[model samples]
Target: MSLSLVLTLLGAIFLLLLFRYILTPLFLSPLAHIPAAHPTSVFTPLWISYHRRGGSQALPAITRAHSLYGPIIRLGPHELSVRSQSAIHKVYIEKGGFAKPKFWADEFMSYGVRNMVSMQGGIGSKEHAGRKRDLGNVYAKSVLLGSGVLSDVAARVLRGMDEVLERIVGEEDNADAEKTGSGVMEVYNFNGAVNADIASSYIYGTDGRTNFVGDVAKRNEYFEHHGTWLKGKHGHAESQKWLEEFGVQLCGPGVSALRDEEKGGADAVVYKQLHARGLRGNDMASETLDHFIAGAEAPRTTLTYLQWELSRNPTRQARLRTELRTLPLDPTTDIPNLKALDALPFLDAVLMETLRLYTPTPGPQHRITPPEGTTIHGIFIPGSTRISASLAILHHNAEVFPEPGVWRPERWGGGDKERESLEEMRKWFWVFSKGSRGCIGKDFTVIVMKLIVAKMYSKYETEVMEDGNMEQEDKFLAGPVGERLVLRFRAVK
Candidate 1:
């Protein structure tokens, strides 16, 4: 063939390849029928990335799209956002045909390591199930009843609070005494200290032999360093690529320290015991540690919000304190029984309400359709299409949670119809998520939250400091907006 003819043939092949790989997927894919959140949604990742970086705006934007485009809205060339409760259940619980999408893997990629939370591909589900099974008993409500782990952690938390309270009170008292001859003094880090100690104990174990609560400097260092790693622009992507290139076992120093502690060091002691007690196949130790690390910031955030809310509404705070006092406190001992604390109705109501209003880490749970395909909201979704449901949007849905922003625990504690409505709301409460992929450390979280709130309210009166910012920061996880929460606390007597 002539040179001109050969060039024309090559040009034709290039055009065909471009159309097949790029144009068709962007403009003619199965997702084309759905509404796009941005003008470029059919073509690029810019829209999603913009919302991701927008922090608090992320969920609201997705919610708007869902409202406009029905339950399932096209987010990208291959992604769909499923906002309705029925759709969420169908995709996440009943179908079980969708796998966690790559975004999570991208977002949480560590130093050449992929923990159960961020692992990708086919192996993740089996591995996660195995790991979850291994430590199930360790986190069971029944196990916590007799577990020394609970009491030991509670003691450590009380000790930490004492120190924190003493320091704050001393400062306040000194300032007050200088200004006035005689005055009452108070302070509150009640939530922060308690959450820190509880998280530390759960991760490091209760024996006092291997306690992260004791290693304050190290814990601070780890969180600070890991926080940097978590936020670096390319950290997650680079880390994931490194893991794929090198073996996951060969994680870097930061991740290695975390994993080693969970797998074999003193931190792993509690988990090892659970494993020995017939909790087979699961890696509860590592999973628990991961859960603690991933979750530590949240309870502190919740506590800060609770304190702020209570401070603003002294009557509510007083009522809660009365409720706490009415419960029998140990006459001679400092700690209350786990069952009694757990069963405190008012405390439970307050926490449930707090969780409802200020959901920690209220992000979307994303999944992709299986090879066999599936249908959502009566629309057929092809295999490999991305699907997600946002807990923030669902929790704040006006239909389910009237006056959703209001903090009213009483709404959850009324007559049959009211209680039934609250229960229905709880069924869709995605705070810890649901189904097989639900939070593994939920039991531990509840226990610690109850014990901390119970212990604090039992002994001290709390108020939000005047200068503190009570709003929550909506990051990868919702944390205290200001990064620090200072409160005023006084001895109950």
Candidate 2:
């Protein structure tokens, strides 16, 4: 009506908006009691979002926040970063209490489709469980040891390693007299290739999968796409399409029919299983790509670091070699008995120690607070808000893991003398995470790592030549910063 009346109404609305969006969240909301990582975090996510984009600095900053302000701190108007054991347990293992955050989809999708990592809510839960169930029997320790499928997979991987060893000796013999390993094998890419081949073979079949170990440049190219995808670098979407097509080709017509593939021959092992469980064509391919992407990074990272640690100590390497030598069969055999191979005390400790200190995926797993709203370190967090716990905080807890950053294989002991400390260490070990939604690939990865490590140490001795940027990248699925781990492997006399 009149200008004065309109102006008065507009002023009232402005004040109301201010109170609801800013003042209330800053000083009057339920989260008001929690300390803010940045003053502006009380009103907006910009403060934390900026830090997140800061790359490797984000986790350290959050760790400082947790150190300064107790276990729970507000990172944004709708987000919280939690660090206490109680909070992490309640959030992750309280019967699937929290839904995964939205960023999973932003970063982890394959050809614009939901994989197990990107899916959320009830549908996500059902799909994930179905997939896990389909592979559970296959991944079981007993099955992996005795089953023909894994035996064949193991046979192929060992054959590849035999080739790698031959090349290592050949390179040294052919090199200049002074250059024993001037051209380091740069086995990180080869390790990635072998693991990718094994994962794909298991998902598809030896016939259907990649022979990247036989083609280092092609394998490295596949990993080049991985770098672009993980960094969200330019052309990630385009690269994702290429990855999806690669996965589709790996799971073509008769892959599932192979006796060594998915136990039931469902969609064609992994692809067929997902398809049968309702992941349409490309989505099935997408999920398969998710597995390959996962198989490519974390396992390779573990193998890389394990080698790095071993290379630093010749005494430890010899001890490990002796332990590996105790195996009933040598590296060149059809395949070592999984049961006997896994029992090597020194080998297991070395792997466990590396997993503890050098976890590849040592990043925050974002989970939304559930409807019921939970308390973390006695601070109540509201429902439907983004909340997370980083593996770094838990794994590096000095109280739980003394000298946490140092790599000491002896710390993971099997004897009566160290059993007590080992128990405490297990509680803090979140490498594979823990929860109803925890990684189903834990056993598979562990077995693969053990197999690779056992085989490598048994045949050759590695020394790190140039591991530029050994620091783990600060991403959800991180590897080394430079993406190159150069090492010289010499055939054992």
Candidate 3:
């Protein structure tokens, strides 16, 4: 063929490629009807990817997009961010839930194995349901309330609180002070230690639990690795390995015999359930490791922010203490009954408000549309498109939560009054999310956090000594900026 003929063919092919790859996605596709977060989002994921990389400003940018573009907006060429309740139901509940995106596996898988959180697709969903069934009874609200597991967990939390009190009092005594607790304590790390201990004990029983609360050196060593693994800091590979090995050791031979005496030699609930389900060796270990991962950091984040809020408002803190004191203490243990502690209206309000305002895992949970596709909020999202809903965005809806940024526990109405408003707010609440894929550890998290808060505020009034950079970081497991919450816990007279 002549050179001119070849040149003409090449130009034609180039135009066809442009139409297929760029023009179709940007202008001809159904997703083009949705508003783009950035102009580049119409044809590429580059804009949102840049924001999400290294935990950069994704949440803020998405929030702004939702505010400007209504409830549904295009996040990338094939990705969408949804905020309406009806859309959430359609995606998460209507058809047995959408498959999780690859990000869940890439980010959450532990010990080179998939747990429920990291699992994906039809097979993964079946396995997840099976696992949930195996462990459902133990995590049930009634069982958790009645069992020795939570009782032992509560006792352990109190012991941790004792150490905190001692540290504060000891430092003050050394400084020749007369009043109790004039010394500053970094609570974020301590809270992490306390949460880890609680989670391990509950999962493996007291015998396999780490005594991080009593052992500062051990807590520091563990947190150093854990924080490194979580944040992708330098040396993260080694840190990740160290964490996995630590989990493996806890699941070694004969570790299953570790039992709680209070339960009349009942084996550790989770380990027993996993063993009965025929998960042995690394499988069992990896499953337990996932529980540890789930249990530790989020509660720490909750407690840290809860205390920060309480410290900033002394009147509300005082009111919480009064409500806490109303619970009749167990004469022997000197701690309130787990069920009664859970029933405190004011305490529930404060916790609910904190969860609403400063949810730890407030980032988007990415899900993929089914192969056949479906409509979300009247918009027909195409098959296999990436879509997500954020707990942070839903929790901050101004219509549901008036003055959304303010810390007003009363907005929850202490569980009785404002019935209509409270119902509306609850519909928007997604802290633990909803539907079959919801958090399996919801009861565990709430009970442990309540126990810790009940124990702390009952005896001490916290005051912020130095809470610099308390703004919560915008990440999957959001925590306070600066990773420090210094406060002085004054003894309540």
Candidate 4:
């Protein structure tokens, strides 16, 4: 009961607490055996979170960690990043045990409603599967390539191309020569406009679609507002409300047109599918709004990068145009056959290479471990551990992709000798991710990108006008940091 006796007991308890909380996790835990991205990573997530805050710092730092430590590295006390083919199969492919973290829900929820992207575990998983099933058919590769879907998509894309051409080459007689004639066009803005126009056509039907592609003033307004809202220039609450109202406005016409007894247009593909499965009101609107959002962003990033890359390399552009010339043209529309376009070897090579280098969703596709736990690269990860694999890292594996930073499409053009290397590269390609929960809109995005690229290159030769600050932004769906890609177009003649 003396004061000295009390002090000795207090020191004993403090040492026990330190050993249990800090020392054990730092040295004795199974996760400690894995390579740490930073000295504090074994006990705290602060290091990783600090780097990942904003701007494009996390990617380079993580890439360096993988280089120093091999395939799997501990990003935090409970977070692991693996960049191996085996990890991809086990985490994303082998069944669906690794569920998405709430990050998707927090970032992707539309109209304050959960769609597939925002759905987590529990009944949410089942609901997501049902929603995917309802809308699967329209986005299927076969359906997208079919005459019916292709014709509708082609009409929309080509109409957008007309606006682009008019903007670039100008009309013969116009009061405003500046708006009409050959000059620098912002590829990023035009890319979003066309993608939005095409995606909405399929979502709501052609009759209810936005004419952003055809109407230059309207497209400028939409993109400008989006930029301002994203920067939080106006208050967050006000910006979010404006976004919600925009979603409603975007969806209203399609919903009304679909209900019409004498609706005479291409099928409201997504709406019909969802209605058939019994979703109505905000439920239907959330799913459609998410689709419109998806349609607008990632594809636009891909197209922008594709144009930027091709514009910088004239020989590649010449080669691509030569390949495009071989496509069989449709007698009626003058557009090439969609199937033939997909088959062009050089065109496919160009696209595959662009996706490899500038993956839009280059950030980690995060997944949490099962309750049972699992081993990755010989290191045992505990249950409910946070795990992820970044396309930015995997796609840059120098072994799979020699000179990983270089933009070389010929790497994808595997002849007899490079077949083995080509197969290895494909195994590491996670641009869309893989498995049951992979991107449902892959086919739609791919076909649309091909249509736009093929049509643009065939008619005009592009040269870079301004490409400063072209480093891609560091976010889930990343674009250029400056969000600008200006290019000058000259008619092929």
User: How many residue pairs clash (N, CA or C atoms closer than 3 angstroms) in each of the candidate models, in the order given?
Assistant: 6, 4, 0, 0
TM-score quality measure for candidate 4: 0.92
Flag regions of model 1 displaced more than 4 Å. 1-28, 54-57, 95-97, 106-114, 121-124, 170-193, 207-219, 233-269, 273-288, 331-333, 414-420, 467-470
Per lDDT, the best of the predicted structures is 3
TM-score of 1: 0.79
Candidate 3 collision pairs: none
Which candidate tops TM-score? 3
For model 1, what is the error of residue 376's alpha carbon versus the real structure, in angstroms, after optimal superposition?
Answer: 0.5
Tens-digit lDDT track for model 1 on 213-324? 3354444544454444444434645533432332222112223334565565443333454445453222333334455555465676676676667767877778878877
Please list all clashing residue pairs in model 1, or write none if there are none: 131-283, 186-489, 187-488, 187-489, 188-488, 188-489
The C-alpha lDDT values of all candidates are 0.61, 0.75, 0.81, 0.78
lDDT by residue (1-493, candidate 4, tens digit) is 9999999999989999888779988888889899898888888899998997743337777888889998899999889888888887888888654787876455667667888777765223676677778786888888888757556666656765765576556644332123424655677878888888888878877766777776778777677666555444455556557666777776677667667626554556887678778887777888887788788888888899999999989998998998888787777766777778788877888888899999988878888888778888777888888888888899898888989998888888712244337777888888988886788888888888888888788988988878878898776667888898878778886
Residues 47-114, model 2: lDDT tens digits: 78787783443787788888888788899898888878788888888776477777654567766777
List clashing residue pairs in candidate 2.
Answer: 256-268, 267-272, 267-273, 268-272
Off by over 4 Å in 2: 1-14, 54-57, 122-124, 172-183, 253-280, 330-333, 414-420
The global Cα lDDT (0 to 1) of model 3 is 0.81
RMSD of 3: 2.8
TM-score, structure 3 vs. true: 0.94
lDDT tens digits by residue: candidate 3, 1-493: 9999999999999999899878998778988789999988987899999998885549999999999999999999989999998889987877568888877656777778877788774323677788777775777888888877678666866776676686675574432222434556778878887788888877776677777777777778887898788777789999989999999876652264543343466646787777777887877888888888778888888898899999999989998998898898777666778889888888999999999999988989888998888887777788889888999999999998988999899888775565338889989999998887888888888988888898889888888877779888877788887788888877777
Evaluate residue 146 in candidate 2 and report its C-alpha lDDT on the 0 to 100 scale. 65
